[model samples]
Target chain A: MRPQHLLHQPLTTQKCTLGCPILDRCLGGAIPCNSITELVAESGSGKTQLCLQLSLSSQLPASHGGLSASSLYLHTEFPFPFRRLHQLSTNFRSSHPCNDHDPCDNIFVQGVHTVDQLLDIMPRIESFIKNSKSRLPIRLIVIDSIAALFRSDFENTPGDLKKRSSLFFKISGKLKAMAMGFGLAVVVTNQVVDLVAPDEGINGLKVGNLGCLYSSGRRVCPALGLAWANCVNSRLFLAKDDEFVHQDNQLVNGDGGDFVSRRTRRWIHVVFAPHLPKLSCEFEITRKGIFGVER
Target chain B: MEISRLPISASQRGKLISAGYTSLSSLSSVSSSALASDLRISESEAVEILKVASRGSRLGWSDGTNSVINGAQNAWDMLHEEESLTCITTSCADLDNILGGGINCKEVMEIGGVPGIGKTQLGIQLAVNVQIPREFGGLGGKAIYIDTEGSFMVERALQIAEACVEDMSEYSRFLRNDVQACQVKIQPKDILENIFYFRICSYTEQIALINYLEKFMSEHKDVKLVIVDSITFHFRQDFDDMALRTRVLGGISLKLMKLAKEFSLAVVLLNQVTTKYTDGSFQLTLALGDSWSHSCTNRVILYWNGDERYAYIDKSPSLQSASAPYSVTSRGIRNSAPRKYCSDHQSNV
Candidate 1:
């Protein structure tokens, strides 16, 4: 038997569209299946909003770039955004009137407070998927902000670091295997932390390239260092920058440009992806859902 | 070959053999500390055993009586090989001149810059230009482009390939007097087809794909250029352990260097720039810290020079430290026309 043939088969060719045409196009059609895609950003950048939007979209019919399946939303950050999910469901209902089923009814929400709890739930999730009573198969598994579970779990000792990294690999390894076996799309959210540069002198900084990544205007890197970074198949960075917008309504002529208002501009950057070029596009989060602004 | 053959104490030999390190080759890669822990011996005794094993292996090699030293080449032969090494052009005249005709094969070259400084453009240009027929003074070989940042666009590659085809046909017209050189058999589609694209999602996959390149390259011997578009993206993220990151990067660089030499192909590693806090302020430098600087045979830093894209040879053993102006034109990397001096232009990180 040709082992190469089995290995070369395109395993992750399916995509669950983000529901917005421009955003989907930016992500090369949609969130690819059989891979772990991470969303990293500071708070209020709409990482959870996007995940909520995805939970609803995954329930959409296959013709609309969905799996026509259910989603498992595992949240580590508090009080499941029930109201926001409700608002999104109403919009989803209006958008696709043909589907009479409640978009919210299909989503399975599980709150995890600690790292041990999250790890313990892995087997249950597998069993749930294997013997799901619902008509739709679970095609999406989302862990909203994976960094939260590990934030206070371990201290900064070498042994603790090793243990934390091993746990990271363990979780991701299981997630990857589940994704490949079940053909599900795994979306994990990660928070960002202020990057503290090493105080090592100029020569020290030059000895090891400890460069920093900037999001919005602040110098921040994704929470959970390189070990977690290696676990995700793709990383999407969301940033918001406050910009002064000209208040054109107050001006009678083009010269009256002194009146301005401040507004936050949000952008989604493809930090790294196997199928995407390094690209970024502006997006907005409204009551309806997240939509990509055409450039 | 066996552990018993080592000139070590009988008890130590018994422990090593019982612990399953029965051969010298198996013990070769094992560290003394690890061997000591596994065999329940002191570190000093493990070291002695390792020393004797190495000596025994050396004697075994001599007993074989091979004429040539294994994998060793004299300096004179190496010079001849280096002189004949081929280079894949970036298609920009000034960039090519400073790059010593073009990006030299059998060596690893790292090119890094800030976002949108045309690193991907240069990578794609080289991927297309590598396929330029030998008649046109090119390598006429295939290219393997490993895109880590998803920055590689097929539409952009297609456009560059079309432009490359046009350039070739135009050159053929100039060499019309030489009847054999006027045949432009390659097409834009063919150029695109010749490029094998790999989309790497994670650092592990990136490392795995790089390791797999040896077997892949052996199968497709015509692959003369390996382009890794941004090797630092995954390695720079989420890594809290600086020591492990350094060791991982070092191993990868060694593998890449070996692949370059063994396959006689150009290995171009595209890198991203990171902000470094130095002298009480943030300064933009290439990603993947200082130790990674020694990984490649050549390092080229791309930056903005008063509204013009310039590439500076930051480090190279043979090439002089110099900078040249280039541009990312619609047709891909090309020579930039001298622009009016603008003092306000600052490096955009």
Candidate 2:
């Protein structure tokens, strides 16, 4: 193919929207097709919540900023959050009344336990995406928390490190190939690790300023480190913050004094992306679904 | 070492093993011209085989020894890099002054304090402030937050980020003459987005993550700060093997120090305070023992002085032992309010 022809090639890659307009705008028109997007956060930072919401949103029509396709949710964190999924589906059903069939039926949920199991299911997942009987083709794949599988499986030895990193490449490489080959949006959730300082005692090692990033008043960095960081095309960080919002209710209610309430505020950050700038926006998870909070 | 260990073709390995050269050391001493005739190979092929053998041999590797002298840098270049090193402001001018213009890049700084003394707040502030554009006298770099104790609050980070944005806009208003200075394109959300957060559960995972940071920082070259909140949390708990913990911690610290220097990024290690029995009395000291103290290039202790919080420069290679009062408000770390003025106002009221 000529170099100029490459530029003129029609952009056939579609986007699977997060169902939130503000977030879609922040993400430069939702999650792009043919790439891996990583959702990194702590346990309660709503990584699963967003994934569950995506599973339903991807089923929406193309006019609504969705791929108008089915989804495959490869969940490592169980028991699958089915109750939450049901609630989100109900909300999804109410929002888009045009679809006759249930949106939940289109989402294929699979439980992945080990790295081997995840790798074993790759070919099956590809075949499923390729030759599905349903009208809605599988255009989205969600791996809820990729870090859990490798967290305790590997030892911290030189040999194990090599194996673990190679596996990381293998898994991500397959996922990327499948994504690009099938025009699927692969979203994987990853855990975080505490960033520590390098010691000065070790010989032949340079010591320098050690800094950290914080979320919810705690220091944290994405889990799995550099090997995994390189695998994903984009990384989105979800963080929650707890603050005491004092309300002066004394004037409104004659007897009531100042009321202090602790509120948990959630935020989503675009750590790095090929198309979007490094940005963040406040988001809240509600019964309706996960939506970006207007600034 | 066996001849099979040499990275060569299987046919060459078979020929070498079939001949007298069963071990890598035997081939290491053989001349390429002599080996070429004996092995029935070309002179260039023999040279290649011998080169691989020497590299595989234990004592025949002299390339590394020669390269060490070649890699040696003069003190002048070191001084130049040091002079150009930028700092991530703590947002507290007094604290930044004591810190020699905030927490400097290319150094591992240990900030230890009692719980609720705002160690995490300062960490979040640095994470937010580090993203300030270079035009505003900031590094305009990203951050890597490794949360061990699960104390990182995103809400607190947003609050700080908002304050940083407000401060930058205020700064831009002051410098309206300069076109670039007038345009503050960064937002609070962008500041939050630039910070990469990691949560570590165990000391082993922490070590693994630290080992992984060298490569991580290489790929994310724009990252200029790495913060580990309370580096002592996992080490201090369930660690009966003191020697092993020390060695592991030493390795991790060394890796972090290397990352800071290599990436020109600042690493801030938050530590907890422990009571030490010394001089017939128990006094508060930074946790992870005395040997761990030498791991950092600088150490600052946050303490409460009556009603105010004070950060004391406990130990540093270049900085003097100085104390500065700073407070962690809802907005983030800032200069402590004048206590005398507050007291007089209260008395008048």
Candidate 3:
């Protein structure tokens, strides 16, 4: 097959049927259906929340700029939160009113424990996708993280690197091929590691007089180093403010109104992407899932 | 008592190598009399060899370094050629003047700034600007941009490239792709095609790219500029061992210096800043610490003062430390005014 088929225009240049509300913020325009996009951040930066929202959003009909299809959710790091998924689906239904379809039926969830399990299950999933294409819409694929298994299995040993890197590349290569071949929106999440200590604060937190008080960590780049970083086409960094609060969905308005109980603001910084400029937008996690905070 | 200087035979050197005494430091660490018995050399000669090895390791390179020694007249001839050496204009005349007419081809210059201060923007502009034709007072060459932080934006480069094409009519003679058309319209796509872009994710990849650069440069001789966007990002973050990182950084810098001098290519190294707590408030400093402070031939500090962006010449042997104001816009980096009038008004104050 000609690689020319793989060189289709990015979603930014094409008219996206899925009118994702926050598309202009994190992503420049539409979801790049032809390339692999990585969302990397520290813990509790709302990566899973974004994935949940995407899973539901991709289920919307094609008239609203969605693939009106199913998604394959691979949770490699943490337990799948079906409760949160239901809440987001409910919120999405309330907003659109017409998209009354049971969103869960459209999304396929799989939990794999080890790297070997992931590699083994991937081909089966690919074939299943091929067979199920006519039955349902398979739009997006999210591996909660591509790094969890590799980070744990590879013990910083010189001997394990060759094996580790090859596996990493193999997995990414498959994801890329599947995304291009099937025309899927692939959103993978990655974790970040502390590079060095930043300037000292009152108690290890660096305070900016006018801005947010982040921790004194010098470099908080994504984990898995450069080898895995180069594999993805676009990378977005999620950072949360130091203000932390816990509340229930009783505070969120189903009509996308003002939030009653104060929610911690999360920022999604587009670290690097081909079409998007370097910018960040404030977002928040509610019972409904991640959304751009209405100013 | 350097063994070779003491008239040691070739067989004795071979025996020393076989015994695992490969370096002077390793040899000097052992007891001389005990080593003498082990190597079957005379006691006095062994003692003398140990002493000389210790002195050699401790003292400066009394032995020759890898660099060649040139006479003053020959060096003066090089100095004369340096005057006509092609420098890449940074688009801002004042900044270029402070930079001694943009970036000198035979020198490695560093531009340091914090995360969002447009250090990468400057590097990208230089890469795009390198394609300006010589007839229009441009470098008339291509660029090699090695992006380490994954910060190289092709769309942004396209924006800057499109902005550059607005003024392409005057420089069309040096940049025309074909002789068939008398009036040529420069395409931004052609400018993008001229730049050689390489994105590296890890420190190992960065080192490998630096090692592979010589062959690549020789093959692409039209590339007159090399831009390493934030050299410390990979080295600083991935290396758990600080010493190893420094050693690798040193090797990379040395390789860059060699590449600049040998190929007559200008090297622009973008650096991220570190935060240093000084006088109660935190001050921004260059990352990679002092060991790397001396690596660049010239160092310019990019910082924000109140509203406008200022570039200060922090270190240069031939020029005094001075500051010039510049701004980041859709048209790329340019003079902050009419800054000549603004600075004159400020100087009087």
* Top TM-score prediction, candidate number: 1
Q: Kindly indicate the candidate among 1 and 3 with the higher DockQ.
A: 3
In the range B102-157, model 2's lDDT, one tens digit per residue, is 98898999998764467777888888888988988899999888876544545557
The per-candidate count of clashes, in order, stands at 13, 54, 7
How would you encode candidate 2's per-residue C-alpha lDDT over A249-276 as one tens digit per residue?
Answer: 8888877788888999998876655444
Per-residue lDDT tens digits for candidate 1, residues A1-295, read: 0112211343236789898999998887778887789998999999999999999999877778899999999999899999999989999999899988898989999999998888898999999999999979999999998999998889966557657866776788678667866879999999988756543332122111113445668877777765566566678888898888876763466675567788889988876564554567899988899999997
> For model 1, what TM-score is found for chain B?
0.77
What is the interface RMSD, in angstroms, for predicted model 2? 17.1
Residue B30 deviation, candidate 2, in Å?
A: 34
Off by over 4 Å in 2: A1-295, B1-68, B178-181, B344-349
lDDT of 1 at B295: 76
Q: Score the docking of each candidate (DockQ).
A: 0.03, 0.02, 0.05
Error of 2 at B45 (Å): 28
Provide TM-scores for the models: 0.61, 0.46, 0.57
lDDT of 3 at A5: 14
Model 3: runs farther than 4 Å from truth? A1-22, A25-27, A30-51, A55-81, A87-295, B1-76, B170-185, B276-283, B337-349
Residue B206 shift from truth in candidate 2, angstroms: 0.8
